[model samples]
Target: MAPCVTEWVTSCTNLILSATALHSSYRLFKDHRAPSVGLFLLGLSAALCIVHPSGSYLTSIQKEAEWAGEVLAPALVSFDFLWLSEDHNTAHILLCGSCLLLGLCDWLSADALTVMTRCLGLSSLSCCLTVCLFAGNALGALSGVALSLPLLVAPKVGAITFAPLISPAAAEGLVKWLLKGSMAVGCWASTRALSMFLLDVTDRCNMGI
Candidate 1:
């Protein structure tokens, strides 16, 4: 069936464009600046898939199957299986570690870093810190899904699963805080309004207007 261009307008592509605009807005706000809980979770999801349980990084898929029976399914509620194995838990550690690394690195700068610069966060030594890390991250995430398709659909020869992140663990702590700073800042922003609403409704009934 030939589809509707109008409906497609509200799809993932649209949402991403909107997010880019918001991200840009946040950057402006910082100067402006950026991500929070929601963005952190989203970033984590992309990272895990790239570093798939099979691990194209530390090792190839075949070498890690026994251990990766561990990573396939995302921990919907917690990080239990993620860091569960203690010693050999490469997949979980790398996935979560990436977020923490990014958060801690970005805090040093006053301005928001781009995806190319994301890797710089991993290393203070990166000369093209902005391009190597931040821009790399942005590219990785935008491309992460398409990269995971083969693993996601292929028959499971191993115990692991390449999946999207769904739990709080994915966000780490600092990353979530960065992404959701606006939410926190907004909370502070709404406090005066909240106070007036509360006082108007309960304790101060004597006002005439």
Candidate 2:
């Protein structure tokens, strides 16, 4: 797809904070089990999004990434603060609750391979079908093979809060690395979800959902 500078730059900036956050979270992963839990959490979160009334927490996430961007993913645990559309009470609680679970799962799935391996079929299916909801899955799943590079290369400048990728001065020291990772991973998926939601289809393929 031809890239839009605004969207591209925004996506890149989001990458920086996410990479930093993942790097920090890795430290907390003791042994292999932590990663296992992380994957489970991610899987669970995805499942919840699929089953919930308003397609899970995708709405809250959509606004967060569009506005909050990077911090939205790294601070996955704090997804409670994500944006809202048309005032949804069930979605709000479910969104926060679901994000909390997904955070724990991601902490367990340390590597993308784990999720990729399990979701391989879905990933391929996502590519074949242009399900409006899974729109991002096409390139997203393919990119899963090398997710880290983008994480490192995406811009870190003009970055706002929790954007650890930005050269934060002592003033911005408040935002830690873990927060960046949480926002990155969470927001990334959230954006993808929003894409699917906006398109309004739940078929397996689009962004490799």
Best by TM-score: 2
lDDT of 1 by residue, 111-166 (tens): 33323133322221121122224323332222222212222332222334323542
Worst 10 residues of 1 by lDDT: 73-82
Give one clash count per candidate, in the order shown: 28, 34
The candidate maximizing lDDT is 2
Residue 186 CA error for candidate 1 (Å)? 32
C-alpha lDDT of residue 173 in model 1: 27
Q: For model 2, how does the per-residue alpha-carbon lDDT over 35-133 read when each residue is reduced to its tens digit? A: 223333333333232222464477565432332222122223222112212224533543453344435543555455234323432332232233322
Candidate 1's displacement at residue 173, Å, is: 31
lDDT of 2: 0.34
TM-score of candidate 2 versus the correct structure, residues matched by position: 0.21
**What C-alpha lDDT values do all the predictions have?**
0.28, 0.34
